[model samples]
Target chain A: MTDTYFVAVDWGTSGFRLWVIGRDGTVLDSTTAPLGMSRLKRNDFDRVLEESLDKLGIAQDVPAIICGMAGAAQGWCEAPYLCAPTRLDALGEGAVSVRGATRNVHILPGVKQMAPANVMRGEETQIAGLLHAEPSFAGTVCLPGTHTKWVQVKDGAIQHFETCMTGEQFAFFSQTSVLSHSMILDGWSDNAFRSAVRLATQDPVAVPRRLFSIRADMLVRDQDSATARATLSGLLIGQELMSVVHYWRDQSVTLIGAPPLCEIYLMALDVLGVGGRSLDVETTTLAGLAAAFHIQTGTVHA
Target chain B: MTDTYFVAVDWGTSGFRLWVIGRDGTVLDSTTAPLGMSRLKRNDFDRVLEESLDKLGIAQDVPAIICGMAGAAQGWCEAPYLCAPTRLDALGEGAVSVRGATRNVHILPGVKQMAPANVMRGEETQIAGLLHAEPSFAGTVCLPGTHTKWVQVKDGAIQHFETCMTGEQFAFFSQTSVLSHSMILDGWSDNAFRSAVRLATQDPVAVPRRLFSIRADMLVRDQDSATARATLSGLLIGQELMSVVHYWRDQSVTLIGAPPLCEIYLMALDVLGVGGRSLDVETTTLAGLAAAFHIQTGTVHA
Candidate 1:
């Protein structure tokens, strides 16, 4: 039995989730808090790390691997962002250095592609987890989150990936836009989503023209909020799928994320006549951290 | 000349504009303030009026006529709303009681049409001003503002009108929507507006399809904010014009309000192949009140 411990942290904008694991990658204990990177002040990452570790009864000396925006420029530590079209081996220089931490800490770098404005911070971890989950998981692996990522997983490795701001944009439009008054705020409406997806995929070119119909249909026809939200979601996801269908069609796709978000990707795939299966890689971040920690310490357990 | 002075109060939601005129309809002194009906607390309207009148150097005894939302359910005083397809004679019941200072205050009632979900409070004054400018003007008098009004003017009367929440929707979408990041905040672009208008008018039925394309074009082609703004404006105005083109194609249109807002209307008319002249009815409320006063007092000046 090995005494070396491993930890995986999925730190998002507003929340931090950490999973404590043993040598076999079995989660021993898990904890979550609202201390996301956005709430931290300048140069306060060390204190936050201590607080997180203290809550878990984990010693500062225990090595931990972190992913997500924690390593972003706005993160607790200014971990350099890795350029996109990247791979797990080419994650470059690894996590940022922090001072005054109770234990050794390493934050994963996010990938950013300049050409198409694609980016990912946390989805890379999920992609890595999906790859780890399936050894021969070649083809495309999609991890949907606030920023949905389309990663090309080949030869047991994450070769390349792209991020779309579709999720964030959808939330903004549905909650804050004028259409907010006419959209479904709570609960999911698959019917509305399906019709919207149809509108988007069948006549992909008509997306720009059909947006006003959302308002007009509401005003003139009294369309319900659910339909409106679905219509909007369909348009955005449809457009994204349309752009990537050429690359994803006739290939295998592995979806990873929360069930609801993953369902959206499945729906999009189904609409495009693509075959795919969903893997419940809920703790992909932990898996990814396990992989990275092995590489960092060069400690392979028997 | 009679000693009685008439006051025309164009009290709207966010601001109040008043014109103190002699019985002959000459604007003696004008005043405007930010105390619109929407901002006033319960019973605070009297103070707003008193302060506004003090600025205009007008006494409380003047026979004042108030129009616009100042008489709605949330206004200074509830001037009963008039149903649409109404005649000029069916406006506010001669006078409404004012609480504060002693004055013969007459509030013009707003129009509320049932079928189309159209309602207007202050537009009657603009429509009245349009009739005053061209006594026998027929066809549609398009008054574009935060909420645009397309009133069909015929036989020296407002035959029918429809209201579209285009402007307010545009503002909401541009400032708070996902498109906000892709659009400009200000500065009018006629070229962009014209192109959008062309698209809207040429294919009113396809408006819903084009909305998403705006973002695509902006993202893929790096289009300017001006083009985005104009395209949005054009799409709305073009759709609106297409709705009422048959009603005013062969008749005359008198555009009212500020120069810039009126330009869009003029452009819409031009796109519809309709002839119309832009009229700067700077003090439309005062003129409207004068006409109403003449009709009420039976003065034969014209």
Candidate 2:
């Protein structure tokens, strides 16, 4: 048996990560770098990657697997989007060829949707990881993050997905909009979160009015900044809740991803009366890459 | 002929103004400063008035009258809001006894609508000016500014008013929102303005989705920053147009205030097919105060 060190990389827009794993699928070592795609040109990918690995005392000959936005057209390479009903075995194994690297560097493909103009990168791995963690699940699995993806997994295959701007809109309104000054940098308000869920659930039609009130209440009435944050969170989340009510009406949801993000969606789900459970798909991207690797290497785990 | 110089003052929240005028309402001299109500304590009205006069090289004893937000609760004094169907002459007339100023400083009351939670402080004078400029004019008078006021003046009386947050929303979105980076601050695009008006008129439902598209287009397709500005303008102005469509549907509009503000409203009015004329009620605050002065003192035209 030729033992190989496979590096799993999750490179986002802001940072890069590389985890070296043994044949036994345990992380032997890991390394990270601040060289994100946002700061690099099309040609600088190889140099940056080599330098990142060199910093971690890793040789260039290590076989690797990459995921996330690093494979976008503007990233290291453009990874084609995987279509629906795609299983772990269906993701064809290939490597993005780079010079002077003795080992193969495979990049995972993302997913895309035409309607409502939505796309996702690197989430496929996470979805694959979800499937790996729960080999036989049948429900709407929501991966809520920067670009929230609600994927329908049933009969052991990825059926379809819809992307929501809930996360991005929240960040935009919180940090970029006038509501920023009113929202505290840190601190959780379940009261706000719950009220937001209620507002979204009850008077969803009044979203346009509520958005302005978020600022007006703070500036004119001198409402507490904390309340403003809560109100704002509620407003955006509420708006999203309204937008996606039809999807959750008769479906069970399995929420995957971080806690806070999942918690917010869970609250909305509770308000929406969608019976669901949240599962922390541990290191989903790694699991996804491993599944894809196993499917390619003809390793049968069953 | 009692040649008492009729002083017209445009006193509002931000500042106070005193215009020394001949009996015919021809200004002899005028002065203004930042002695707005914000700097004044409850009893400091007298001192603030004196200071404003001193800045304008006017005597503290100058006979002056004021209008606008200066009479609100937080102002130098709380001048009550007058209800609709009230003539200019029916506004509260009383002498506020400010110490150290020989002239009697009378503050004008603002107009309020209790049912819809709306109020206009400074525009009352402008509305009065519009009425004074065009008495026997029965139609809609659109005062387009920071808080765009669509006021109905019927049968030579201020009938009703509603304020839309057009200008302020524009400023907030243009500067604070994600659209800020893309807006061309040097000048505005009339084409963008027209398109926005058309969009608002035709499909008012798509405004919110279109707002998000600005970011997506910029990021994915590398759209111009200028498109962001026009798009925002379209969304907001379209929203404003939609909001005040009822006012413009069956009536002609007389746009009051400065040129640019009037132009946008005029554009919107044109879109609504309301035959309108932009009446530059230049220095409306002064003219309003002058008319108020004439009404109070029973001064004949010189």
Candidate 3:
């Protein structure tokens, strides 16, 4: 039997993922549940963690490292934010320990920027993993999600970052706004997307008006549902790109997220003549948690 | 009892307002209901109109003039759009007559712009009313609502117009988005609103980022809900202003809308250092509908 060294948990607002990692730096076992921080009360966190460990047959002796909204003020334990410019490797120092827990439990802190007033949880761990994988990485790192982050890193630290509600806007608009009547979920049109991207990027201020055009297109020209969805997505991504083009204009961006979203970003970047590469979200998150664990146990140099 | 010469109906997507106008151009009596064009099926439109007329004891001999969603493709009858560079007074010529009804009914057509693709139903009539009230009125006319319109009018005709989804965005965001957590309905902060308007107008591309700042402001600095609401309103209106600044940059604009919405636009224009005046939505809508009725019956001169 492989010896389980520690448990890595990425406890987000609406998701819970746990991994039993062996001493050999490999995942021995894993489990995922919908018991995210949002679903658990403060007292339920310990019981929920214990239940998951019991189901996975992990011994109580195995220490656990947690990140994401579990460290939010309303989560298991409050892990306050570390203000930028923050060193990626020093994230472990800000970890808050869960009181009265049988096994060692450490929740990672988020990163906050004061000037532009930005806050990022969970994604910081992914950034840490990104830094560990490419030790000398610099330039921009984009983590696209409900609240997408465009982070600028330099010399192993996050210099600054900006957050855009692009994903959230897309979800809300496609589900609740008038655009819902025109958007379809299953198909996509690359040409429609590129055209929208070009239009939005060329005239960012025209965003509000352009958004209405999707409906007009449907009314006047009988636009298809798939093309409408792609156009909507492109319009949003293009507007976001316009806002952050200065951060990654000539530099190659490191996109860390789920494949479908990252693919969209890559396409949009291609249209803008910007270069970028993609990395899986889970791998980066696990690597980041492992790095923090190593720092916590004083076993490895960052 | 005073004579009710013609019925004027401003039938929107979710609201129905009717006014019985005398030959003297005075409103004899009026009633409002929730039976908007959207609420009634195609077959139910005539029945609903007849019922409302019956409730008001209106004579069957009276002709009716209808505007807004009642003329949409999915409404009682499709009143096709009149392409831009259209004369306001000529709107009566574009009115589509509804068949199989005892009384004569005319549904006014909306205006459509091809280049940047925008459509306006009901508001065009309001523009006509503005033109009727102020014959030499030129420059820009703004009708702010669920879909706000910025019209470029010259010589009593709509040269071109752009629609911004600012009001719809405000309603959706304040009620459903994450920003809802930070918003309050009752109080408002003029200072916070002005500051946000200034920021968004100066950097319109930063609209998305600025929106997230509302949440960050609440999270980091304990921002008040009223301030958050004001800031959100300011940000959206400011973005719209940025998009249509060319229409009213140095000109004194005529604003037509409900007082609350118009007042906000007025404040936003003031922040942008643009001149503008406000008119009541109902008054303008009635005037427009009356003008359409006159055109259909050839009763009044433009």
Q: How many clashing residue pairs appear in each of the predictions shown?
A: 19, 2, 0
Order the candidates by lDDT, highest first — what do you get? 3, 1, 2
lDDT for every model? 0.69, 0.67, 0.88
C-alpha displacement of B78 in model 3, angstroms? 1.2
Model 3, residue A75: displacement in angstroms?
1.7
Best of the candidates, lDDT: 3
Rate residue A178 of model 3 by lDDT.
Answer: 79
lDDT of 1 by residue, B1-302 (tens): 44547777888888988777776657777888888876887478777776777776677767777888788766777776566666654453444556654566767777665554456778887777666766776677777776667787667556667655567657755776545766865656888888888887786645543554565466546767888888878877786676566556778777776788887778767766778777765666566767766666556433
| Model 3 per-residue lDDT tens digits across residues B1-302 | 65778999988899788898887878888888898876789998888889999998998999999999999988999999999989998889899999987689999999988776778899999988888788898888898888888899998899998888888889878887778878855579999899999999999998987888888888888889989999999999888888887888779888998898888888989987888899987888887887777787888742
TM-score order of candidates, top first? 3, 2, 1
lDDT of 2 by residue, B126-189 (tens): 7677666667778788887766777878776677666655676677667755456455444567
- The positional error of residue B33 in candidate 3, measured at the CA in angstroms, is 2.1
Tell me how far the alpha carbon of residue B95 in candidate 2 is from the true structure, in angstroms, after superposition.
10
In candidate 2 chain A, what residue range of length 10 has the lowest lDDT sum?
A94-103
Error of 2 at B129 (Å): 3.5
